[model samples]
Every structure is written in C-alpha cells, then in structure tokens.
Target: MLELLIIACLQDQCREFSKLYDPAEVSLLTCMMSGQSEVARWQAAYPEWQVDRWSCGERSTRAARL
Candidate 1:
C-alpha cells in the first residue's frame, strides 16, 4: 500500500542519496539513524528495514546497496 509509494519515492530519490555515498543504501541506513519522523513511518511499513540491533557496533560489511 503506502510502502510501495514510499519505496517508489526512495527509488526516485536514490540518485540524490547516491551522490554522497558510493552506495546509496548506506545513506539509507544512516538516514534512518539520522532520526527523522519519516524513518519511523518507513520502519512501521517495513519492520525488516533494519535487522534487530543491526547497528550496534556491527560493520555494514559489503552489502549490495539497493
């Protein structure tokens, strides 16, 4: 429902995010942690957006950024 629309927006805006990050997904993760209301809404829509406690000192590894 709303997630699809939000993801579409993210996909469209990915180019902008990718500019600062070689892989824009990093920015996605960081963007979440940046603490905005949208992040919560997004998380509510996608509970799996971030693995439980994934950011607790865990290195991002070489994940393929969507």
Candidate 2:
C-alpha cells in the first residue's frame, strides 16, 4: 500500500494528515505524480494553515494523524 503524507503548519503549530492508497490501485509513481494536487486541495479547504512539506511513502511510516 501507499500513503500520502501532508504536513501543515499554523503559526508554529503543525499537524499531519494521511490517507492510504492501495498499491493494487495506485502505484508509487502515480502517488508521487499526484501528491501536489492533493496537498493543494487540502490547503484550499484550510487556508489558515500553510503546507510545510509532503511526500509519498509506505503505510505506517509515520504515527501521528489528524
């Protein structure tokens, strides 16, 4: 499986949001290719926070979620 990880910050506070995409359906290349648009959509919905960084990785690579 693949995971789309996004890190956003408001002032000095930060939060992470993650969603899983099955490898059977979405490959790593596809995840890498489309991650920016996903992050943009998330940022648009929550304009108060600025996205710090994002990446595609294997599931369970990170622990915190919101």
Highest lDDT against the true fold, candidate = 2
Expressed as tens digits, the lDDT of each residue in 1-66 for candidate 2 is 689988889999988888689999999999999999988998899999999999998887465454
- What is the total number of backbone clashes in candidate 2? 0
Model 1: colliding residue pairs: none
TM-score of each: 0.25, 0.85
- Judged by lDDT against the true structure, how good is candidate 2? 0.88
lDDT value for model 1: 0.35
Q: Please, what's the RMSD in Å of model 2? A: 2.1
